[model samples]
Target: MALEFSPETYKKFEETVNRYPKKEAALLPVLCLAQKEFGHLGQEAIEYVARLMEQSPARVCGVVSFYTMLNTKPIGWHHIQVCRTLPCALRGAERLTSFISKTLGIEVGQTTADGRFTLSEVECLASCGTAPMMQINDDYYENLTDEKVTEVLASLK
Candidate 1:
């Protein structure tokens, strides 16, 4: 089926649009709704959102490419994002990421064969104090050790 939001999502989108003085201001939230419905914002979805917002496809694509939170391709069910910023790096985030890659048998930016997890090396998760953290889907697992990371992955499985 073609990518489109549900009727309920359209209602939410309308409400979001009303919240903003300009329809362009609603682009991000509408794009978010489109992504949630379609799982990823491919070319089709990007253009769809652009037309809905009365904006150019290039403009929409630019926004999608600029944001780390936005994805242009399919990701696994559990998107594991490891923070590699200065604070996280100082706290062994790289080692932790390596451990996860080894454990999952998939390198960063690759999804596992089973389609259960996608590992991504991201910039920062804003958890500087709780460094060495990886976000699984929406939940953050912090202060990771090999054993703890293993336990977390096993629990998800």
Candidate 2:
């Protein structure tokens, strides 16, 4: 079946488009709406967004690829993003990531077998002051230690 947005979401999409001077300029928010509606920006979602925005699929795809916040595939219930920039690295982000990987029994970029968590080593999350930190779902856990990671994961369950 062809992909589409629900009536309410379609209305929001229209509103979003109207807010922009050009339809092309609304690509980012429209893509976000599509991601929310469709779960992830798979090929169908990308094509649908392209058709709605009168953009080439390649263009839509380029935007998705450039933005780490956009997901091209489904993610686990808890998406754990570890910052790996210089600031984070110096503060033991690497160790934190390794600890998370071991605890979850999955490497970076792989979802756990039970689909509870997905681990990713990403660029700066703009919490340089926090240094070693991880963003789980939408919440940020900063100044992490092994025990803190365990405690956070436990609370999630």
Candidate 3:
């Protein structure tokens, strides 16, 4: 079957378009709604957004690829993004990431078997002063030590 937005979500799409001078300008938020509805930005979601926005799939995809918050594939409920930038790395980000991977038993970019967590190595999250920081879903975790990270992950349930 063809992909589509629910009536409530379609209303949101319309509202988003109404706020913009052009549908093109609403691409980002519309795509966000689509992602929220579908769980990830799959091919069908991309194509659907493009068709709705009167944009080519390539253009929609380009925008999707440029944003780290957008996911092209399914991820776990808790998406853990560890900073791999120089500042974080210098402050033991690499080790923190390794510890997370080991604790979750999944490599970076892999979701856990239970589908509870997905680990990713991301660029700077602009928390360089804290360093060794990570972003779990929408929240930022900073000034982490191995013990702190473990505690945070344990409390996620």
Candidate 4:
């Protein structure tokens, strides 16, 4: 399809642009729309978005890479990002991440063969006070234990 978004997406992009004082300000929202429609901001999609926004690919690429929320590769139905910074690490985030990988039979940055789950080791989820945090989809789990993670995964269909 030569890297194109739906007409509806384009319409929304226009509306988003109109909402902002500067078209460049629409970058984030339009990029968000691109992610929603494409599921990731890989090279092809980044190029397309840059073209849509009249931006250089380098500019758009930087934006995509800056956000952990943006995916550059295909992911699973469930995206699990475990915080691996100091606090979470001390709280056993590494163990929890290892546990999730072992339990799920897929390592970090890899999706299950069935595409059910993807595990990532992120820098910080901004929940140091809670420690040992993991963000599954939009929900965050803090104070993690192997048993807790097992239970959480079990509940997923």
Using lDDT, give the best candidate's number.
3
The whole-model lDDT of each prediction reads: 0.90, 0.92, 0.94, 0.89
Best by TM-score: 1
Model 3 lDDT tens row, 15-60: 9999998889999999899999999999999999999999999999
Query: Residue 134, candidate 2: how far off, in angstroms?
Result: 1.6
Ranking by TM-score: 1, 2, 3, 4
- TM-score of candidate 1 versus the correct structure, residues matched by position: 0.94
The clash number for model 1 is 0
lDDT by residue for model 4 over 1-157, one digit each (tens)? Answer: 6988889988898899999988888898888899889988889999999998899999999988887778889889889999999999888888888899999999899999998899998888888999898998889988888888989999885
| Model 2, span 1-157: residue lDDT tens | 6889999999999999999989999999998899888878999999999999999999999999998778899989898999999999999999999999999899998999898899988889999998898898789999999999999999986
Residue pairs in candidate 3 whose N, alpha carbon or C atoms collide under 3 angstroms: none
Pick out the ten consecutive residues of candidate 1 with the lowest summed lDDT: 1-10
- Model 3 Cα displacement at 103 (Å)? 1.1
What's the TM-score of each model vs. the native? 0.94, 0.93, 0.90, 0.88
Q: The CA-based lDDT of model 3 is what? A: 0.94
Model 2 lDDT at residue 38? 86
Screening candidate 1 with a backbone cut-off below 3 angstroms (N, C-alpha, C), the clashing residue pairs are: none
Candidate 1 lDDT over residue span 56-93, tens digit each: 99999999998777889999999989899999999899
